[model samples]
Target: MSAQESCLSLIKYFLFVFNLFFFVLGSLIFCFGIWILIDKTSFVSFVGLSFLPLQIWSKVLAVSGILTMGLALLGCVGALKELRCLLSLYFGMLLLLFATQITLGILISTQRVRVERSVQDIVKKTIQNYHADPEDTVAEESWDYVQFQLRCCGWHSPQDWFQVLILRGNESEAHRVPCSCYNSSSANDSAVFDKMIFPQLSRLSPLARPGPSTDLCVVSAKSHIYREGCAQSLQKWLHNNLISIVGVCLGISLFELGFMTLSIFLCRNLDYVYDRLARYR
Candidate 1:
C-alpha cells in the first residue's frame, strides 16, 4: 500500500475504535436518563419530591436530561455511519441540547429571585400579624430592620430570607398552625414565645454574630428558644440541596460536550477516508 493508503487505513481503524467508545458512552447516558424518568428508586425521584412545592424545577431538569440523552444517541449512530442526512440531524439535536440547558438555567435563576422576594413578603406579613395593630410603630421598626438586614445579606428581592423561615415553621408545626394565627401575633401570643419563635429565626440566620443575634431577637421574640445545634442542621440541609442541583447541571453539560466532540472527530475521519478512496479510483 502507498503511504497515503496506509494513512487512510490507520485513520479508519482509529475511527472504528472511537466510534465504539462513543456508542457505549451515548448508550449509557441515554439509558440512565430513561431510568431517571421512570425509576422511583432513583435519587432524582427521591430528592425531587422532598422539595414538595419546589418539585417543578426538578421535573424540568429530569425532562431536559432525557431529551439530551436521546439526541446524543442518535448523533453517535449518525457519526459512525457517515450519512450526510444523519449528520444534519445530529447537529440539530446538538442545538436542541444547548437550548434546553439555556432555558433551564434561566428558569433556575428566575426562580431564585422569586424565592427571595417571597421570603421578604412573608417576613413583613408575619410581623404585621404579630403587632396589636398592623400599623403599630414597634412593628414597623422591627419589619424595617429585618428587611434591611436581609437585603444587606445579599438578598436583592423585595422578599428575602423569610421563605426559609416560613418553611422551617411549617415543618415544625407539621402544618397544624391554625390558618388565622399562622402569620399573626395571635399565634405568637397563644404559643410559648420561646417554642414558636426562636427556632425559626435561628434557622434563618445561623451565621449572625452577637449584634445580629440581638437583631434577630427584636425581629422574632421567640428567637432564643432553640438549641444551638438546630442552626447547624438547617444550614447543612440547605447546603446539600444546593450542591445536588449544581452537580446535576454540571454532569449534563459535560456529557453533551463529550458527545459533540466525538461526533466531530468521527465525521472528519470519514471525510478523510472518502477522499483517499477517490484518489485510488
Candidate 2:
C-alpha cells in the first residue's frame, strides 16, 4: 500500500476511537445533568428556578452533552464511510461548535467580575426571602445547602444575616446565624427556632411560604458559624475552578483542530490513493 493509503487508513481508525471517547464523555456529562436535576436527596434539587446560573447548569450540561455526542457520532461515521460529503458536513458542525465554545469562553472571561457580582446579587435576593415565608421550605433548604456545600454564610458576610428579619426583632442582640452555617446536621434541630422567624418576616418580604421542619434534634456544641461569606467563597471557588474549566475547553479545542486537520489530509489523499490503486490494476 502507498504511504497515502496507509495514512488514510490510520486516520480513519484514529478518528473512530477518539470520537468514541468523546461520545462517552458526553454521555457521562449528560447523565450527570439528569441526575442532579431529578435528585431528591441532594441540595442541588432544591435550588429554585430563580437561582440565577444554578438552575441553568443541568439544562446546559444536558444540551451541550447531547450536541457533543452528536458531533462525535457524525465524525465517526464520516471517517468510517470515507464519504467526502459526510466528512464535509462533519467539519461544518465541528466548526460551528468550536466557534460557539470560543465565543462563550470569551464572554465568560471578559465578564468574569460582572458574572460573580451578578451571582452574589441573586444570592442576596435569596437571602431576603430566607425565612420570609413559613411555607418556603425549599428556599430555606436550598440556602442551607449552599452554606453547607460552599462552607460559607450570608451573602456578603456572616453579619449580613443581621439585615434579615431573623435578627431584627426587639431583642436586637446575640450574633446568631441560620444553624446551617455552623453545621448542616443541626438544621432540623434549629427549625423550630426558625419557624418562629417566618411569622416575623411574613409582613416584610412578599414571597410564598414552606413546609414545617419535623424530627427535632438537640443542638450539639459547635464552635462558630462559617466565618467567610458565601459570596467570597463562591468567588474563590470560581477562580480555582476556572483553571480546570479553561483547561478542558482548551484541550477540546485542540482536539477539534487536530481532527479537522486529519480530516482534510484524509480527504485530499483519498483520490491520490485511488489513482495509485488504478495504476497497479
Candidate 3:
C-alpha cells in the first residue's frame, strides 16, 4: 500500500481500539450506576446522608455511560467500514460530549463552595441523629456502618456527638460514644486530640446485656475510641489518591480528544480515497 493508505489504515485501527476501550469503560460505569441505584447496603445510604444528590449523580453516570457506549459503537463501526455518514455522526456526538464535559467542569468549579456547604450541613444533621444503630432507620444505620467501615468517629471528631440526647444525660443509646467508635484493637490508637476508650469497655453495666443490634458502652478512657473523625480520614484518603484521580481524568480527556481528531481526519480523507478508487475503476 501507498504511504497515504498506510496512514489511513493506522488511524482506522487506532480508532477501533480506542472505541473498544470506551465501550468497556462505559459499560463498567453504567453497571456502577445501576449498582448504586439498587444498592441495599449501608454504603449508599451513608453517602446519601451527606450528599442528597447521590441518586441524581447515579442517573447522570448511567446516561453518560450509555451515551459513551453508543458513541463508541458508532465510532468503531464507522472506522472499520470507512462510512463517511457514520464518521460524521461520531464526530458530532464527540463534539457534543466534549462541550457537555466542559460545561459540567465549569459548573462544578463555580458552585463548589455552595456544594461544600450543603454537604457540611447534611453531615452535621446526620451526626446529630446518629444513634449507632445498624437496623434503626436508613440514615442512622448508615452512619453506624460508616463508622465501622472507616474506623472513625463523628464527622469532625468524637466531640461532634456530644450534643446527642444521650450526651445530655437523656435516655439514649450510649453515654460517651457509639460502640462503633470503640476500637477493637489495643495498639497505638490515640492521636493528640483523640478520645481514648477504656480497655475494659463493655455494656453500661454487668446486668445490662448486649442488645440484638445496638450496644450501649460505658467508656472511661478516650484512648480506646477512634479519635480521628471520618472527615479527616476521608480527606487523608483523597489526598493520598489525588495523583491517581487526576491522572485518570487527564487520560480520559486525552483519549476523547484523540478520538475526535482521528474521526475528523478520516472524514476529510475518505473523499480523496474514493476519488482515487474511482479513477482506477
Residue-by-residue lDDT tens digits, candidate 1, 38-62: 5423442344221121223335555
Cα TM-score per model:
0.38, 0.67, 0.64
Those runs of model 3 whose alpha carbons end farther than 4 Å from true positions after fitting are 24-68, 106-111, 129-150, 164-180, 186-223
Better of 1 and 2 by TM-score: 2
Show model 2 residue runs off by greater than 4 Å: 31-61, 131-144, 166-176, 184-223, 238-243, 273-281
lDDT of 2 by residue, 64-150 (tens): 799878888888888898888778878887778789988887998899889878877877777777666644445565676677678
How much lDDT does each candidate structure score? Answer: 0.46, 0.68, 0.71
Q: List the pairs of residues colliding in candidate 1.
A: 116-159, 117-159, 119-163, 120-159, 120-160, 129-185, 130-185, 198-222, 198-223
Go through the candidates in order and give the clash count of each: 9, 6, 9
- lDDT for each residue of candidate 3 in 1-281, tens digit (9 for 90 to 100): 78998899999999999898888999999988887666624433444232123456579889989987999899999999999899999999878877887788788779988876786688778777655454444565456667766888888888887777644454543447666676767544443113212221222234445554353343522547888998888778778998998788778778778888999999899887898899998
| Predicted model with the maximum TM-score | 2
Per TM-score, what order, best first?
2, 3, 1
Q: Tell me the TM-score of model 1.
A: 0.38
Model 3: lDDT equals 0.71
Alpha-carbon lDDT of model 2: 0.68
